[model samples]
Target: MTATQLSARALLLDMDGTLVNSDAVVERCWRRWAAAQGLDGDHVMSVVHGRQGHLSMAILLPERPVEQNLAENRAMLAAETADTEGIVPVPGAPRFMAELAGLPHALVTSADTGLARVRMAAAGLPYPELAVTAEQVGASKPDPEGFLKAAAALGVDPADCLVFEDSQAGIQAGLAAGMRVVGVGPRAAAHRPTVQVADLTSVRVTRDADGGLLVAL
Candidate 1:
C-alpha cells in the first residue's frame, strides 16, 4: 500500500535502533551499569531498549532508589553519548532523512535532547526540523505522549501522522496516538505495526502521479 492511498499527513520516526544503529553502544553502556550492580548486562539492556531511561534503570537496579537509578543512568547515557564510535546511521536512514526533509517529519524518541544530538551527529544525519525528546514529554512510549507531542508540534492531528518505529513501546505509542505505524528492524514484528519492513532499506517515499507522497515498503 502507498502512503498516498492512506490519509497520513506527517511522519514520526524513532531514533535509536530505527534511524540509527546504536544497539551495540546501548548494550555496552548498560553492561557497564549491570556489572557495577552485579547483574547481567545483556539481560538489563534487553529490557531497556524502547523503554524510558528511568524505567530501564528501575528494572535493572530495582534495589536502588528511583532517583538514584535515574541519576546513574543519565550519567551513563551522557558518557555513551560522548563515546559514539560504533554508532552510525542505519542503512538507508540518511537517504530517507534527506528525502523526507522539507516535509512534515519529526523525531519522536525516548532519548533526551543531549543524547539524541550526540547520536544523530555521530550518524551524520540531518537534524530533524522538529523533534520531541523524553524531556519534552511527561510520559514516554506506550503512553502515546511522545508521538502525540510530535503530532502536536507538527500541527497535525493524530490520525494524520504515520509513525516509523522499531520498538514495541514506540509502536504502541504511535498506535495509541491513533496514527498508522510502520515498524522497522528485527524486533519490529512484535509490535504488530500497520506495516512491517526489515529495515529502512526496504522502504522509500515517492511522489505518486496524483502529486501525493507514496510511502512504499
Candidate 2:
C-alpha cells in the first residue's frame, strides 16, 4: 500500500467505527430502537454513526422530547455495552495503534468511559491515556467539542492534531476543530477528508530523534 507522508504533533481518533468494528451490535441496537419508535431504520443508521446516542435519537425523532431522548440514549448505551457479540477491532487497528503507543494521542468518542472500555476490550485494543468521551463534552460530533477537548488535554494545538474518523459527523467535527482529518473508511468519503484510507492497516509512524513523528500516511 502506498501512502503520502505527513507530520503532526498529535493524533485524535474515533473509537467505535475507526478503531473498532462494533457494527453488528451498533446496528442491531439502533435498528431495534428505530422499530420501537416507528422511525426508518435506514435513515437512523445514516444519521447515527459518529454522533452521540442522544444526538442520533433527537435527529431520528425530532418531535420527541429531549428528556425522552436522554432516557432512551442511556438505555441504548447499557444494552450495547452488555453485549459484545461480533465486536472486534477494525482491520489493522491494533497494529496501527501499537505503533502509536507512547505518542501523543487521544481517543475521542461519542461513547462514555464505561462503554468505551467494554467495546475496546471486546475489540482487543488498548485504551488511550488521554480520552474525551461523551460525558466530558457538552455537545457531540459535528460540534467539535470532543476533538477540541482532547487536543487541549494533550497540550497540543488543534491545528497540529491529525484526526482519524469513520463518520461524516466525526470528520466534520475534526475539520471544525481545525485539525487535519483522515477519513478511515468508505462512509467517511462523503465528508471530504484531507486523506482517505481504507483502514488503519497501512498507517505507519516513525519517531525522529528530535521527538517528532513522521506519519507514513
Candidate 3:
C-alpha cells in the first residue's frame, strides 16, 4: 500500500496492543478468569482487547452483575500487573515516542493509572505526561468518551486529533470521536482505521509549516 500522510494538531494513543505488547500477561490473567467462569478462553480473549477488564467480563458474561464484574476485574488487574514476563514495547515504540517529544500527544488507554504505569515501565517506554486512563473515563473504547476527553484535555478539536490504535474497539472509539486513526499492528488492519500501518516503525511524525503534526503512515 502507498504511504499516506495525515495532518493533525494532536495525537491520542492507546496502550496495550498499540505501544506495549502485553498480550502474554493479559492472556494469562484473562484466560485463568475465563476458565474459572466456565467460559471459552479464546472467545474471551477476542472481546478483552482494547477494553477494561470489567467491561470485557460484562461482555463475555452478560448475565453477571456489574458489581461482580467489577470485583473480578480488580483481581484480574492485579494479576496482570504482577506478571510482566513477556511485556515489551511494540517495535519502534521507543523511537516513535522519542520523536513525539515536545509534540502534543496524550495516552488514552483502558488500563487504569497503576496498570498503565506498570506496563509502560516494564516495556521501558516513556509514559506520556498526559493520559486518560480507565479511571478517567465513564466508558471504554467503542464509546467516544475517552478519546474525546483526551482531545479536550489537549485543547484540540476532535477532528484535528489522530489516534494510534491496534484493536477493533480502539479504532471504533477514535472514529466515533470524529478523529482519524492510524491502526497499528495486524489486528488493526481488519478494523478499518483511517489508515493502517504494520507498527510504529511504519509511522513518521514531523511538524508542518503551520506547526501542526504531519503523520506519514
lDDT of each: 0.83, 0.91, 0.92
For candidate 3, which ten residues in a row score worst on lDDT? 195-204
TM-score of 2: 0.97
What ordering of candidates by TM-score runs from best to worst? 3, 2, 1
Give per-candidate clash totals: 0, 0, 0
- Between prediction 1 and prediction 3, the one with superior TM-score is 3
Compose the digit string of candidate 2's lDDT tens values, residues 1-217.
5679878899999998899999999899999998988888898899999888998888777898999999999999999989899998999998988998999999999998999999999999999888899889899999999999988899999998999999999999999999999999788888899999998888898886778777886
TM per candidate: 0.91, 0.97, 0.98
Off by over 4 Å in 1: 1-7, 207-212
For candidate 1, the per-residue lDDT at 106 reads 95
Pull out the clashing pairs in model 2.
none
Residue runs of model 2 more than 4 Å from their true location after superposition = none
Q: Return the TM-score for candidate 3, rounded to 2 decimals.
A: 0.98
**lDDT of candidate 3 over 122-180, digit per residue (tens):** 99999998999999989899899999998999999999999999999999999999999
